[model samples]
Target: MKINVMTDILEANDRIAAVNRQLFDSHKNLVLNLMSSPGAGKTMLLEKTAQALRGKLRLGVIVGDVETARDKERLEKYDLPVVQLNTGSACHLDANMIASALPHVDLTNIDVLVIENVGNLVCPAEFRVGEDFKIMILSVTEGDEKPLKYPLMFRESSLLLINKIDLLKYTNFNLDEAKANARKVNPNIEIVDISCVTGEGISDWAAWLSGCYKRKFGTNSLA
Candidate 1:
């Protein structure tokens, strides 16, 4: 009975997600769902990506967290359309939450929408929130075993950003092992090493994002 209920919930969520995807497609907006554990620098990466891609593409963000609007506050400096969804106690964001937040942002004017899912490696990957790509970030501080232990996020993501390389020397994390495990799960996942603090590899990440945008909307990104 429990399994059937869970399956039904996911099916319903997928139906809403398909609707959301169609809405985004109609507006020519490329939506990226960003997920990571707590303290993995998801917000910081967005700040840097926003700066890197500013003017090149019109951006909007949907910040999802269990509580508090702190992440939304940090992103408000950009003055772009921002929506904060506080799930209260939910560990992850779902398609319904995203569908609720879409009305708050002007989807017609935004070229790309970044949905920052609540900090969790498990449930977030199970739910699709109408995104073009799921970009997962794993800080070197989180250790190399994460990809093997939390294989779903690694496998489900289209791109993986190994963040916080500045602390790589201090920590015992192995870049090779991390890449090997991630590649084992997702053979085609595009992985990039990034440090949001020092601004390392931000351009590559931003370029990949913009490339998706240009490919989706063509040369004229006025949409």
Candidate 2:
């Protein structure tokens, strides 16, 4: 009975996600769902990405959190279209939550829409909020064994950003082992090491994001 109920819930969410995907396709907008554990620099990455792609792309963000509007406030500094979805007690943001927020976002003028899911490595991976791709972040401080313990996020994500590399000297995290473990779970996952504080590898991330946006829109304006 429990399994059936869970399946039904996911089916319902997928239905809404399909509707959201159609809306995004109509406007030729690429939506990215970003997920990570708490304090994994999700907002910091979003801030940097928004600033880097400021004039080149019509970028927008939907910030999801269990409480607080702090992430939304940080993103607003970019001066682009931003919406904060407070999920109250929900651990993760589902397609229904995204559908509710779509009414507030002007999809026509937006080229890329990034939904920053709640700061969680687990539950968020189970829900699809109608995104073209899923991007997951894992900080070095979280340890290299995370991929094996929490494989679903790694398996679901198309891109993985291993953040906080600058702090490697202070910790015992092994980059190769982390990559290997993630690859074991998701052989096709593209992983990049980045540090939001030191500005390391931010350019590659920004370029890749721009490329994705262009691929969906099919234009050379970003280049």
Provide the global lDDT of candidate 2 against the true structure: 0.91
**Model 2 misplaced stretches (Cα beyond 4 Å):** 1-9, 221-223
Q: Which residue ranges in model 1 land beyond 4 Å of their true spot? A: 1-9
- Candidate 2 residue-wise lDDT at 223: 38
**Candidate 1: RMSD over Cα atoms?**
2.4
lDDT of 1: 0.91
Q: TM-score of each candidate? A: 0.94, 0.94
Q: Per-residue lDDT of 1-223 in model 1, one digit per residue for the tens?
A: 3454335658889999999999999988999999999999999998887788777888889999999999889999977788999999899999999999888889988888999999999999999989999999999999999988999999999999999999999999999999999999899999999999999999999888877878877764553
**What is the C-alpha lDDT profile of model 2 across 116-153, one tens digit per residue?**
99998899999988999999999999999999999999
Supply the TM-score for candidate 1: 0.94
| Candidate 1 clashing pairs, residues 3+ apart or interchain | none
